[model samples]
Target: MRGTDWLLLWTLSLLWGGSFLFVELALEALTPLTIVWARVALAALILGLALRLTGQGMPPRGLWPGLLVMGLLNNAIPFVLIVVAQTAITGALASVLNATTPIFTVIVAHLATRDERLSPAKLAGVGLGFAGVVVMMAAGRLEGAVPAMAACLAAALSYGFASVWGRRFRQAGLAPMATAFGQVVASTVLLAPIWLWVDRPWAMQAPGAVPVMAVLALAVLSTALAYLIYFRILARAGATAISLVTFLVPLSAAGLGWLVLGERLEPRHLLGLALILGGLALIDRARAARPA
Candidate 1:
């Protein structure tokens, strides 16, 4: 990866990692469906216009179904699950569990295809990374939050599948911007009926300025800008390099919590973070050694 690629990866990490804090803030005002709806809706609006300006036009006719599936897997389902999970678990625990996405991705990819075979080192790395996450959660005192923990894990799995499913678009010849915009548009359309039936946006409380702004931030910055950076990084760097952001998000989340939410990171947090980062490094090293 070039210097610019590294910069984009880290920047993307910060944007996405800080999203937990933004979601927490937004949750004070909106339901999970509502927040996710607003997110994909706003992101679609922005990216769609950008697409139009660049003459990309709407998504191709044959791609809608696949795009909708990707949107559900990538954004809608996981978005709701994480938000609902946060209602049951602390953000720290949630973030730690969420960091397991890449590990899950490795396993899923290994199982889903013959090409992405797992090495002994990669296996060790997954075990170590999962162990680190367990240590982080245990250190953070996760006890008796079964439902929330389940929700977060489900979110991670959804993300893992989405990561793999999204790769198929290249073969489908859909550009990144079109793919992202289509996903957002599909997510918005798919989520609306459920949001209306369950959340009933009309009945939602009128949120104050801060919470409203937080919603917009999640929609615009986290969803839109983050995806833009993500696709760009995936284009410039390899998928493995793109996955490195997973190792950074928890640390970023902890930092954001300290700054914004006045949460304190204890010694245990640092230790757990070190283990997770170390595990990811090992995984990347193992991946680098493998034959292409």
Candidate 2:
């Protein structure tokens, strides 16, 4: 990966990391399903306008099925899982467990594709990254959060498959902006019935300005803008490099929580972050030598 790729990856990481913080805020007045719905639904609307302004046409008629599948894997399922997990765990810890996405991505890509084969360095990197999660979880005194942790890991698994699956849009000659818009729109369509059935959103009370604004940022800033950057990096850097952003996400989430929410950040958490960064460097080292 080049320096530019690293920069985009880190930028992507920060945007996604802020998702946990946004979820924290939105949860004050919304259900997990509702928040997840709004994140993708509103992002779909934002991206749709951008697509119109940029003169990007409708997605290929032949690709709707695949696009819907991509939306489910990449957005709907994991977003809900993470939001639900946040109900029981701190945003930082949820982000930490979310780091496991790369590990799962490595395994899934190995099984699903011939080109992005697994290697010792990638395996080592995954191990080291996950060890960071364990370390931070311990240091944060996070306990009795088994269900929450499980939800997060499930979300990570969803993301892992989504990374590999997303490669198709590039192969099909879709622009990142258009592709991002398509998937979120698909997500909105797919999730609409589910959210309506589960949340009965009409019956729910309005969440007021703060949470409303937080959800908008979560949708536009984190989901819409982030997916544009995501597909761009995936096109240039491949699934492995794109997925490495998860390892950095915890650090960003923790820092944001500390700064804004007054969440504690112990010295031990810093030590854990060191391990995560080392693991990401190892992943990058291998990517530098290997084919995308």
Candidate 3:
């Protein structure tokens, strides 16, 4: 990766890492569904205007179905699960569990694709990754937080599926920006009814200024800007290099959680994080060694 790519990668990590913090703050005044809906809706509006400014048209009709599925897998499901999980766990712990995304991605790819089948190193990585989960689960169990921890892992699994599913957009020659826009648009559409039904914002009290600001920052900085930088890094450095951002996200989230939220992880949580990152390193190293 170039210096610019490195800088973008770090920025992307912070943006995404900060999402957990934003969601935690937003939950002070908003329901999970409402927060998720607002996030996709606001991000869709921003990305739509960006497309218009760039003179890029909407995606083809044939792509809408795939985009909707991408929205469901990548945005709607995971966003809700993470937010709900955050209701029971700290943003730092959630970020650490979210780091298991690549581990799930490797397993999903191995099961779903012919060419991306698991190698020996990848198998070891999978084992270590799950071991990390077990350790984390033990930590959570002590706190009666097992369900929340499981929810975070499930969200990571959804992200893993989305990563594989999104390859179709690339194969079909869609621009990353267009794919991102279509995705958030679809997510907004999908979440609107659920948000209305469950949240019934019409009857609810207005959120405070801080939660509103957190929601806005979550949408703009975390979702919109982060997606832009993510694709930029993916395009410039390729998937393997871009995956390195996963290693940085937890660190950023942990630091921000401690500094801003006064959140701290237990020793077991730290041990779990170490194991998970070690697993990711093995998986990434194996991928890097593969013939292009």
Candidate 4:
């Protein structure tokens, strides 16, 4: 990736990394389902307006199935899991665990697509990434709670599949913005009634500024701008390069947590992060050695 692309990736990473913190704040007043619903709903609204404003057009009919799958995997399940997990884990730690998405994406892409075949390098990367997760789980003294960590890991695994699944849209001739906007709208439509029935958010007390800001941040920055940047990178960089942002998000999250939120990072967490980065390097090295 070019320097500017790298900057964009890191910026995307920071936005996503900060999402955990925002979710945690929102969860104080809203249920996980409610948070997920609001996030996609608001994001869809914003993107819909933008699409109308720019005359970008709607997604193709052939792409709707893929979009629905991506919406459920990428937006609904993982979003809710992360929010629920935030009630139990520190935002930084959850971000680190979530960083494993690319590793999983590599494995899933190998299984799902014929062209995106996995090599020994990718296998090693996947193994090493999982190893890092195990090490972090065993070695780190994390704040919040333990079960939440498990939930976050599950969410990361789901994200891995979603990342790979998302690539199908390109073949369907849908622009990145179209796919991003459509998927959020799909998720909102699917989740809204469920959210209302389950969470009954209207019956709850009014949210304070912090929780309101958290929801807005999740919707605007994390969902809307994040997806815009994601598709922007996808259009320019291809899926593999775009997915690399997964590896960087943990570092950005940890740094932001420490600097902005005053959260402490234990030594084991750093060690786990090092292992993940090393695993990513190994994957890249393997790819470099492969004959075209």
- lDDT by residue (tens digit), candidate 2, 1-292: 9999999998888888898999999999899988888888899888889888878887888988888998899889899899988888789877877767767787799899998787899888878877876776664434547677778889889989998998898899887787777888888899999999999988999788989988998998888888778878988989677857766788889889888898765666566667766776777687778854
Give the candidate number with the greatest lDDT: 3
Clashing pairs in 3: none
What is the Cα-based TM-score of model 1? 0.91
lDDT of 3 by residue, 1-292 (tens): 7899999999998999999999999999999998999999999999999889989888999999999999999999999999999999999999999999999999999999999999999999989988988887864554538988888999999999998999999999888999999999999999898889888899999999989999999999999899888887887889888889999999999999999999999888999999999999999999999998
Estimate the TM-score of every prediction.
0.91, 0.86, 0.97, 0.91
Error of 4 at 266 (Å): 1.9
Q: How far is candidate 3 from the true structure (C-alpha RMSD, Å)?
A: 1.2
Candidate 1 lDDT (Cα, 0 to 1): 0.82
lDDT of 4 by residue, 1-292 (tens): 7888888888899898888778878877877887889899999999988888889998878778878888888888888888888777778888887777777777777888887788877888878877887888885346656677788878877887887887778767777788889889888988988898988876888878888899999999998999888877877787668758767788777887788678766777777777877777777767667777
Q: Report per-prediction Cα RMSD to one decimal.
A: 2.2, 3.1, 1.2, 2.4
Off by over 4 Å in 3: 142-144
Q: Best to worst by lDDT, what's the order?
A: 3, 2, 1, 4
Q: Tens digits of per-residue lDDT for model 1 on 183-267?
A: 9999999999998999877777798898789888888888889988998888778788887888888878877877888876556
The lDDT of each candidate is: 0.82, 0.83, 0.93, 0.81
After superposition, candidate 4 runs with Cα above 4 Å error: 1-3, 139-144, 236-241, 287-292
Lowest lDDT block of 10, candidate 2: 136-145
Error of 4 at 145 (Å): 3.7
